[model samples]
Target: MKKLTIGVVGAGIYGNYHIHTYCCDKNVERVVFCDLNEERRIATADKYQITGYKTVKEMIAQEQLDAISIATPDPYHFEPAKDAMEAGIKYLFIEKPLATSVKECEELIALAEKHGVKISVDFHKRWDPAYNAIRDEIKKDEDTFIRGYMALDDIIDVPRKWFTWTDKSSPAWFLGVHCYDLIRYITGSEVEKVYAVGNKEVLKKEGYQTYDNIQAILTMKDGSNWTVENNWILPVTFPKSNDGQLVVVTEKKYFKNESYRGVKSFTDKKESIPNYIFMNFTQDSASGFGLEPMQEFVADILSERPFRTSIYDGLQATRIAQAVHDSCESGKVVYL
Candidate 1:
């Protein structure tokens, strides 16, 4: 039995999740992190009882980390991941989209291959029970996937307040990547082409230079068509931080899922729907499909098992997203 020393980059909201997850992991002996925000670095280190550095290079030089988990902003994953691999760290767990550009994603993949690094991308929707059920049902028989509709959206505050990089990201990069990856995971196919249209008015009026919503039509290699719609401009009054639904149609089957899974709460100030299945952090443990990808990253490294989602998966998702953006800008179909 062995233990690992893990390093996490970007100590923001999702970064803390990575930190806490590794901290509670039995196979991990220590967890250290780096964040540019002095306040966040101090707060996250204090909360997790772990050392925090101000830069990925500093953390890498100081800690004998067996792996590095990257939780940087949506558009900034490349550098930290590159730093880890270039420094010879053998394992990585990266939050979704991998990188905002296909070239960056491809570079990261090449670096991982060159350095013998194993990388896992956190497209957590693949772990969703509902999505898995859909996958399973489709696998039971040769049902041709005809079409799919997936919409993932966040409340207005998510872009306006959650992070400071909203201008550098869009609904596609932030949310649609999950849907893109999930579509591939479920269908075991690749996106052949994409045609997308998006509106920037809402965020533009607010001074954010990004799309408020993007709707993409994807033609898969398996001949299935998927419509992925993503937005973060839901009225702040929406019960949850986000809302989503998935509907898949096959020749003989239909599958549907809602983010709100029969749970609700009422307070004098607000109404809420608790997505218990996404993330739950207890006193000593964290559980949920959302966290499973992180947990599995640790387990697979210790056991030498393959990651559920590989760097290639990350690359493919980025390719689709990049194409989606290209299509949006050009107002024409983009072939992948």
Candidate 2:
């Protein structure tokens, strides 16, 4: 097998996963990681036992990297990615909420186009096995309402810098973007507009800079409505009612990672899973929600295949995210 050289541009909590999986990957020749935080960079480098760099420029100039993962803070995505494209990396996979603002996000879309680099956003939900089953289920049956949710209470305890901001970004970007992207992908359409309301009062009193919880009514192209609720205030250990309840909908039919009928071998459980709906699926497969998808994406690039989350996909998600922000900002229904 011809191994590829991969580098990481961020060493934050998220970047750790990319580095770990890429380093152990037999197909990866060498791993290089970059981050400004010296301790994080050094610690991750030491643990992974791979090269580390102070800046993206340093890494690009030093390593013959075939691909790079842009896992930096939301505000810093553009510069590192711009550098990687200029250096002619064959592929760039960015963790999403693509950029802090729409303008920067558009520039990224344009840059990747001009440079002809294969790019994908890490909308991890797309790769979920459960989601695949759910999609198949939706096609096989009918549902009046599909309710899916992600919560604030289920994540880590971080500083206000980590969330609660209407200025740089928020938990919506951190959390809601995934739900938005998933809803859009499963629905096979783009989000038409977002009408959302949020409560930052509790966060404000806590001296937090952003909303504590937000719920939005999203209109999709199919004329179907989807609801999204996200928060940073929910306890990380919150008990989930189903599939950890990250995904839930009406009893008629809905797809969730927790419940789906296999398409290959007919199963008795299709009728067994609660709130069960007839869904077509086969072989429970690893959704590649992690390093696995990254590897498959590399294969797709090698085979010249289409990537699921193209630059346009990221930009579209960005547009929806921005609209959600608009709805929150202006206290009015935001038009697409």
Candidate 3:
């Protein structure tokens, strides 16, 4: 295998995965790790045995990197990707919310096209075997209903960061986009309309912009419907038999999965009982974090194949997510 220089921008929680993945890659040489926080960057670089840089510009100026992974926060996708493309990097694997706006997305796409660099977004759901199974299950179905949910009560992390909070932006943009992208992936449709209703009722602080709970109805191009009930405010202390729950219900067969969770499949017989039964949706069966997906990306690039999750997918996901935000405020179904 020919060695190719690879680099990663940002060393936050998710960015760490890129570092780990690239370090283990046989074709990747000279992995540059970038972060604004010198300490975090150094710590991660030391841990992974790679060169650490405080700025992406410096890395591009010095390193002969072929491909780079942009793992910064949702808003920072453009800067690093734009820089990498300008510097003639061969590939970019950017984290979600590819760009904050559609125009920016178009600009980035145009830049990638101009530079002949492949851009891949970290829509990790595309790699989940369960999602693949679901896609396979519904491939031939003309009429389909794909319903699912991603719920997590308000989460308070160690330092209390930007992502898990109550802002005008609910977990919908942060978390719901994942489900939305998966829906598009499975159903092979774009959201034709979006209508949402959400409230921060339970996470009721005096003044908060984000809603902890949101329910959205997605109208697909095929005239099918996908509903998402996103709850990021479910109070963690309330212990239950289950930790988290996600069920994908379709007309013929449905697959339900959870964290510390159960996975079950069932054929709808029109019984009054719950459609999916609880079986072993065990830990081992679930796969999302980076290593495998990054390996797959590398494999695809080397083989001259396109990645499953490309920039266009991220753009579509962002379009639907923004529509969800619009729906929350408009109180009407907004056409996508």
Q: Pick the candidate with the highest lDDT.
A: 1
Candidate 1 residue pairs that clash: none
Report the lDDT tens digits of candidate 2 across residue range 1-336: 678888898888778777766766666778898998899888988887788999999998998888998888777788988999887886998988788678888898788889988888888767766777777777666554445554323333543434333446576787778788888777676777789988887567866677777788887766767778776665433332122234546447544443223323325533223222321212222223555557666677667788888877777778888888889988898878
Indicate the worst ten consecutive residues by lDDT in candidate 2: 278-287
List, residue by residue over 1-57, the lDDT tens digit for candidate 3: 777677889888778767766666676666787899888987997887778898898
Per-residue lDDT, model 1, residue 89, is 95
- The clash numbers for all candidates, in the given order, read 0, 13, 12
Q: Supply candidate 1's per-residue lDDT for 67.
A: 93
| By lDDT: ranked, best first | 1, 2, 3
TM-score for each of the candidates: 0.99, 0.82, 0.82
Count of clashes in candidate 1: 0
Better of 2 and 3 by lDDT: 2
Question: In model 1, where do residues sit more than 4 Å from their true spots?
Answer: none
Please report, in order, the local distance difference test score of every candidate based on alpha carbons.
0.93, 0.71, 0.70
Distance (Å) between predicted and true CA of 270, model 2? 34
Model 3: residues with Cα > 4 Å off, grouped in runs: 140-143, 146-154, 158-169, 201-208, 238-246, 249-251, 261-290
